[model samples]
Target chain A: MTMRSVGDGKAEFYELLPGREHVTVIEPRANPFRLDLRELWNYRDLVLLLVRRDFVAQYKQTILGPAWHIIQPLLTTLMFTIVFGKIARLPTDGLPPFLFYMAGTVIWTYFANVFTATTGTFAHNAHIFGKVYFPRLVMPLATLVSRLIAFAIQFAVFLGILAYFAVTDAAVQPNLWVLLTPVLLMMMAAIGLGGGLIVAAFTTRYRDLVVLVSFGVQLLMFATPIIYPLSSLPARWQFWASLNPIAPVVEAFRYAYLGQGTLSVGMLLLSALVVVLILSAGVVLFNTAERTFVDTV
Target chain B: MPRPVIRIENLSKYYRLGAIGSHTLREDVNRWAARLRGRPDPMPRTGAAEPETREGGGIWALKNLDLEVGAGEILGIIGPNGAGKSTLLKVLSRITAPTEGRVTMRGRVGSLLEVGTGFHPELTGRENIYLNGAILGMKTREVDRKLEAIVAFAETSQVLDTPVKRYSSGMTLRLAFAVAAHLEPEILIFDEVLAVGDRAFQDKCLDKIQDLARSGRTVLFVTHNMGPALDLCSRGIVLAAGQCAYDGTMNDAVRHYQGCAVGGRRQTR
Candidate 1:
């Protein structure tokens, strides 16, 4: 905070007093991995406003408005139930097909919503990013929250279906692990955000990556145990499936809420490690990209 | 008489030519290697070399230039196209990082680089006011305090709830400017977008700038329009070829600017 004086006799010692003045230094290159949570906290109002804008603006002229959030996932669940359960004969591990698919749909839809929205961060918001300065992470983070709200709505609908199955069938088990729902949701967010951010960062320089993103995310969902339970996989292949971090999350979620999927603490820990790794890498890539993407983008 | 609010040292930014995807795999590896081994860049895009990883091929938006702005000074930056006028403002506001040098600024820096940035067409006038304010770094509490003033200044209180897409471009610009005007940062940076609205609104913007200076806040303004810029700025700096060409009183800088434009000589001091 050493400041240069104007060289007049009036220069005073109170110039650099704490809290009275704040200083910012912009350099050509910086440690791109530095995560400034304090600055993000200071701009929390902006995050809330951005989330509100995204949520409220999209439904402005629509007839059904927010109901679309629930409808889209419900229809997707119906499609999955028909195609995967009825046509493909995928096993649902004794739980009802509709309930099983809806369980996975609520969480995966949240993931896809956050992922696809943030994957265009640099391209879509280049104008705002070029003109003003805020922690660029705020854009994607706000998308996560807004989509989380949509997920909440969809989850409530899923619960209604769960309640139907819980009374009619004794197979649906509500276990103590259900209490870990918040933690599971957070893990999924990290995966979506991390994967999205990495793609977004690359898309700034090579926009072709944008084309690959949605396709890749679709492939990712199928690779997970969404359409088919992890138990359906053979012994050798189950270990391979464990490599996909989201597999354990979907399985754990099913085990907690529906009471019938295998989840070892070791498997969960491995997946958590993968999620953290992806998220950190994404943040680092984002830090570097945000600083100079305006120029290249 | 007061401490300088902004201090820039050897500030320079180099942009790659046809910059997208120009970093061939070999070039990237070379750059990464150079950075890791503490060696200079394998290729120098501009003739000037950087301390770390010099760029491969690009133009320097700003060069080895140093400047200082004292507290409460309305320093005008006047330059031609590609003369680093907007680049300077972008660097000052932290919109983009410099490639060679650094800038340190005291107190909050709010930029009106472009008004109506991040304005959702689907959002109403009132909603956009809050959204744009937050985008420009105003806290919700601050925007709340100034909501009435903003509505009055923009004169769109009647259609506050109507979506902005329905508003005329002029009305939209007014609302955006109104929100930007109330940012009240310790330091303000702006581009010449103030010429957007009618003459009356232009005068209001100028008056608001003057009021900001009178309130002891620093202002950094960039404009291609010399007449209005001369009227508003107390001091002026003319830039050419990414370097400062002249720094003096507003009137003198405009004169020197004309001379430099005609002769194209390096008369920096």
Candidate 2:
């Protein structure tokens, strides 16, 4: 069958059977492939409302409120500077340890928060999923967008720090490569969302996997360049480390903003390739899971 | 003549039962391993044969039922508890899939299984109006255009901007049914949702359903209330023991329904 919108006074199209028999050349519309994008578009205000709700609910009624946005990363940067920069004497390529870790923390926070929030999507919203039938993907996408607000708040703080250091002759300067920040942000979001979707799909069948995902995501922070730069790892371990996907994102951020680390163009391209594969697999699995998840969840 | 809006053929669904925790893992693995050895696996232990479909039974809720709902037809399905009315509507709404058969449906399917399916409690009523409308397959502009009417219909104009969490259950139900009424989907499925609202609101909901019927939409209703069933449906089906016991005029179905409730039951076909 063919269906069309009634946007104009002209006839909308809907063909079935004999008159359309020769239309086998066209692709068959499947379960949600025939999804009405117009319907989702119409719900844009709802999407905005969800995004706003997520942003506020995270910090609302808290003692510290949204100030935790800056404080969390500041504390994280201090801890990293103590452990990796002091105890391990990790090289930051002569950049101050605080400056080095803060960049990575702000960028890493975006990915980590998005991943953790999205991974529990089905389990967290079991009540909503069972009742409603909007585009299921909208939940995760709205979460990712909401998290960008937190990232933006932290980034402004990072810029303030950068400005303070530059004026005080603390050896900070905005580099030309900083223009690559948006690309790095996109890569981080893609990997986080793609990985989170895979976890969400698996968690619906095996509930234990949800706990593992939370634990694994935390463990992954140390595996990535969160606490230290990629330079600290040995040459043999570097190749394997770059394969972690988030490693390239962190490395790229450090290279662009801090100007004290190496960013391998080839490795970043490889990370993009891996993200594309992961996201494609995620979409297929998420689509298949949504069919029976209502029953299983 | 309009084509059939919703069609189902020989639809069946099955579910497996097992222990809930890690202790069952060993048995599940043993079952698989025994199957690979080309031998009959162990069967359920004594009393493990409880049917899964009947709220806690292990039998089919619906067995090989064929149904076709024409465009603009208001079909009311009446059945005893466990007669598979809700299960059938769930399948039609694409909330779940049938195990052994297929359903071919044209146009969108909107189901109001309960109030506030996708409503976020922290969001205002205005926000949920759009969110629920989108879930029901209405476009954004359609919701925007009808927003005033929806709030007005529920008499909730004053509370539109208030968080839904603060609304009473009756107020929530009123707003929810109002959104459903305004959705105007090609096929609308209602599963005892009308039973929740107050008497006055139920009348309003019933009147809206009657209006929708006149608007050339197909509606599938499951209810025990015979008056509204007969008022809204052109035809009805009475289900007993997972099969259709009677399918004919609304009055006949109601009569069969009444007889089953009062007299010692007749043998179900």
Q: Which of the numbered candidates is closest to the native, going by highest lDDT? A: 1
TM-score of chain B of 1: 0.85
Q: Which residue pairs does candidate 1 place in steric collision?
A: none
Give the runs in model 1 whose Cα sits over 4 Å from its true position.
A1-14, A17-19, B21-56, B264-269
Question: Which residue segments of model 2 deviate by more than 4 Å?
Answer: A1-46, A59-64, A86-89, A167-173, B19-58, B227-229, B261-269
Q: Estimate the TM-score for candidate 2.
A: 0.86
Share of native interface contacts recovered by each model:
0.76, 0.24
lDDT of 1 by residue, A78-190 (tens): 99999999999899998899989999988888888888988998988998999999888999999999989998999998888898899898999878999989989999999
For B75-99, candidate 1 gives per-residue lDDT tens digits of 9988888999999999888888888
Candidate 1 local Cα displacement, residue B9, angstroms: 0.8
Candidate 1: DockQ? Answer: 0.53
Q: Which candidate achieves the best DockQ against the true structure?
A: 1
Candidate 1 interface RMSD (Å): 2.9
C-alpha positional error of residue B163 in candidate 1 after TM-score superposition, expressed in Å: 1.3
